[model samples]
Target: MSTIEEIQAELRALTEQEDEINESLDALLQERGVLEDQLASLHKLMPNLGLIHNDAKQLTGMISFTSQLADNVSGKVRQLDLAKSRVLAASLRVEDVLDLKFCTEGVQTALHEESYEKAAALIHRFLSMDEAVLQLSEDAAEGSSLKQSFTTLHEAAAKLRSLTHSKFDSAVNSGDVASVERFFKIFPLLGIKEEGLTKFAKWQSAQTSTQIEV
Candidate 1:
């Protein structure tokens, strides 16, 4: 029912609308292409990001391991220092004992000479030396030698003690005043104070009675 002109005008308007739609579609496709390019770029960086994450994890583990290793090393060093100190102390103790060997010989000589006081003094020194050696036994390599020496010294001391007792009794029975006085002084040194006093009092009473009779 429309005229020819109206139909031509409608056809022209429809063609322009089609052109606008096609332009809008073209813009949308361009935007999609840009987004796709950005997504591809991000995908390309994924391996790098994964490598960075792995590196961070490895670094963290390395730090933890290094800290543990440091602690272990520090502990070992402290132990070594303590051990070194112990070794030094032990060496000094051994040296001190070795230095006192002459005192052990002196004790033997004094015992041989019936010098109980000197022997007792030397024995006291030896006891102190033995205590020090015992304390250092954990660190000493030659502890057996020290123990053997101490045993021999102890035996000698026992023998000297027996000999002294016999000599003192002999002197008392013989009524030798000079010998009795000399040995009486040795009794306290030998730690036989009560026994020595009892015997000495009996000998003194006997001497007093004989002097009164004379």
Candidate 2:
């Protein structure tokens, strides 16, 4: 019942519609291909991104450990420094005590041997030791035994000085020239050189006057 022209017109319209659908299908397939490429790229990068995350975690852990270790090392260093200071202080204290003991003993031996010069020198050294100990902190000096020993040595030195003066006077009065000369050598040791010389000169003048009268 359709005319030939009308059939041709409908057929042409159908063909155009089919062409549009085919074009749309081809565009959709191209877009799908692009999406697939993007998905593939993301899959390839996934392991590297996971590795970066793990590395970051490990780095944070390492940083934390290092901080703790540094703190421990600093504490240990402070403890060692304190220990070394204590050891050095103890050694110095011992040395000070020993020096005082040895010098006191030396003075005693010199006085016993009648080595007046040596004894005087040792006495001077003992005086210096006393001064050094006195300069220490009050608590430290109180704890030291050197304080008592210093008192004993001071008393002994005084007694020896008195005995020396008496002996020197006796020899000069007796006109014992040899004894006087021998003791004269010790006058400077006793820090009385000028006094001893003046006395000896007086004794010599008196002897000259007595001889002229004879």
Candidate 3:
């Protein structure tokens, strides 16, 4: 071949290599454009992500506070319940003490008025009262006053028994029907039904014998 023909062939080969390099550059430029779009989208989302992180921190703090508040409220409720129970117990104790005082005074008044049934009823109520409760009141508050009232009531009961027996005997000897009936009914109230019945029967027998002799 001639020298001019060889040079033209070399120039054609160089032109083909330049076309391949331009295709590669175009592909790289498209890839760079996609990366720039992704970066812009990430930048837009960053502020929203920061806000979500702050909201999550606030919600966690609120949950912790709520739990602490519930615990405190529960403790306060228990304390209130315990205090209420104590107040109720103290009120009951005071009521018992008042009842004791009233009974002591009532018994004395009934005896003085010769209201045997009323006195007996008061004594029965006194007997029914819990001794332990009375003792507890004395130990806690009333002390000697409660003890003295108890002693007075005991003596008063014995005296009332003796007085009733004497009155019943006097009524039988005098043949006072109303008085005998009154005293007989009182004996059952005083918890001496059997003794009252025996004595009444003996009196009836003696009266029958006297009538037979007459």
Candidate 4:
């Protein structure tokens, strides 16, 4: 069995590889008409989910899995075939203890629906701790592995850290309820500024209304 550190390193590598795959496959998302036609044909022919995802879903699954692993939100990285989104999501959930597998679950016994702000904070803390672990491991290690691993971790953290502020700003400035809701939706898991976001939304809406009336 691989040690946690080894697994972490593997996850970092996967993040980089999956990022490339995502870029290439993202183009497919624009081809919905042809894709739908193909899917309908397949459905008429009697089909199950594909044994493997086309590059697009596979790319999404890989990136999702890698992101979860890097997040260290779950206790284990579950197995997943590329074609199954739920399987991919489930595997990612297992990677981070903070991931809140189901954002909506049962009673108070369940994680009592964390506010988006709260969820984002938890994710932030988990990310910080993960970074610390990687640093410590590097300090304790005596090879290229440690150096390379720490560098990878630092890069990943940089990318993830910008998530909250960017989304919050975009949503608030857009003055769209949907955007605000989207921001909140990501908040619990993103550790964003909900109060400021709300205030900004309110202010923007008021200003817009005043301008219209003027």
* lDDT of all predictions: 0.77, 0.75, 0.84, 0.53
TM-score of each: 0.47, 0.45, 0.52, 0.27
Q: Which of candidates 2 and 3 reaches a greater TM-score?
A: 3
Model 3 lDDT per residue over 32-59, tens place:
9999999999999999999999999999
- What range of 10 consecutive residues in model 4 has the weakest lDDT sum? 101-110
Candidate 2 vs candidate 4, lDDT winner? 2
Please estimate how well model 4 matches the true structure, expressed as its whole-model Cα lDDT.
Answer: 0.53
Per-candidate total of colliding backbone pairs:
0, 0, 0, 14
What ordering of candidates by TM-score runs from best to worst? 3, 1, 2, 4
TM-score, model 3 to reference: 0.52
* Top candidate (TM-score): 3
> lDDT value for candidate 3?
0.84
Candidate 4 Cα errors over 4 Å, as ranges: 1-125, 128-134, 137-150, 160-168, 172-175, 185-214
Off by over 4 Å in 3: 1-93, 208-214
RMSD of 2: 13.7
Candidate order (lDDT): 3, 1, 2, 4
Give me the overall lDDT of model 1.
Answer: 0.77
lDDT of 4 by residue, 1-214 (tens): 2699989999999999999889767767657768999989888765334534466688999999999887664433332334467676555434432232222121112223523444444445454444443334332334455455345434433443365456656766776667656555554443445754675567568779989999
Q: For model 1, where is the 10-residue window of minimal lDDT?
A: 130-139
